[model samples]
Target: MSLEDLYREVILDHYRSPRNKGHLDSPDFRAEGVNPLCGDEITIDLAFDGDQVSQVAISGQGCSISQSSASMMSEAIKGKTKGEIEDLTKRFRDMMSLDGEADIGLDPDRPGAVLGDLESLQGVRKYPVRIKCASLGWNVLLEALDGEPLT
Candidate 1:
């Protein structure tokens, strides 16, 4: 009915049916991130074909916010080129900051037509503590892209 309700539904959907939630098999890169404050942890594995991310996977356990955010992260970057994925990652990070109304790395005209429900986490700006929870997997994924081991 309302936008908040829609966001809640989106979050719930991701939490209930997590995407890419498993171990990596011969992954090209992997990285892990932990939020000591909340004990939220995530490890992401990335497989790149040249500059494109051919596949992404993860294994982790945490609160619904962390796990669902990880699910959304995996889904958003699938089939995306390295540059495009990086742009989306920046956009997602900017959204979490709620710095302004600009879509940052997104096409302002189209918004998140492609990212779909995953964009609902923009509301996370309201919960400062949960910001790290939502970013856990994304940060780890970035490390994987950088060819760093999961720390």
Candidate 2:
């Protein structure tokens, strides 16, 4: 299959069968994010075992991009350490931003390897408004991890 096809499949699969798409009994951290223009809202809960995130979950209503991004975020960070999560967030943000001048230290190829088919969403930059939808989960995750509001 082609790269675009692979990326589309990754996104569609997440949208169709999201991971961590519900509430947890108790959470180590929680954050809520909303994009008023698109009416997408995400509530993220994280459970940490020491510095490692033991569990992660999300509950919300959103467009396909927002919901699927949340699912991918949950799957990506569940067993990672805070530092690793932060790094991944930065890489993902940089990848999505597509700011030619941005100095994201890591070679996009290595991390993009893990991003797998989801990398196709990099084209999301072409749709300015949809950017927020794609970033909903990322911002929420950062806020929850930092114990602060995202805005």
- Please report the candidate that would top lDDT against the real structure: 2
**What local distance difference test score does each model get?**
0.76, 0.77
**TM-score for every candidate vs. truth?**
0.82, 0.82
lDDT of 2 by residue, 38-71 (tens): 7799999888888788878889987778888889
Note the residue pairs that clash in candidate 1: none
Compared with the true structure, what per-residue lDDT tens digits does model 1 show for residues 44-137?
Answer: 8888777777788878889877888899889888888878878877777777774444354544477457466666776677777777887788
Alpha-carbon RMSD, each predicted model:
3.6, 4.3
lDDT of 2: 0.77
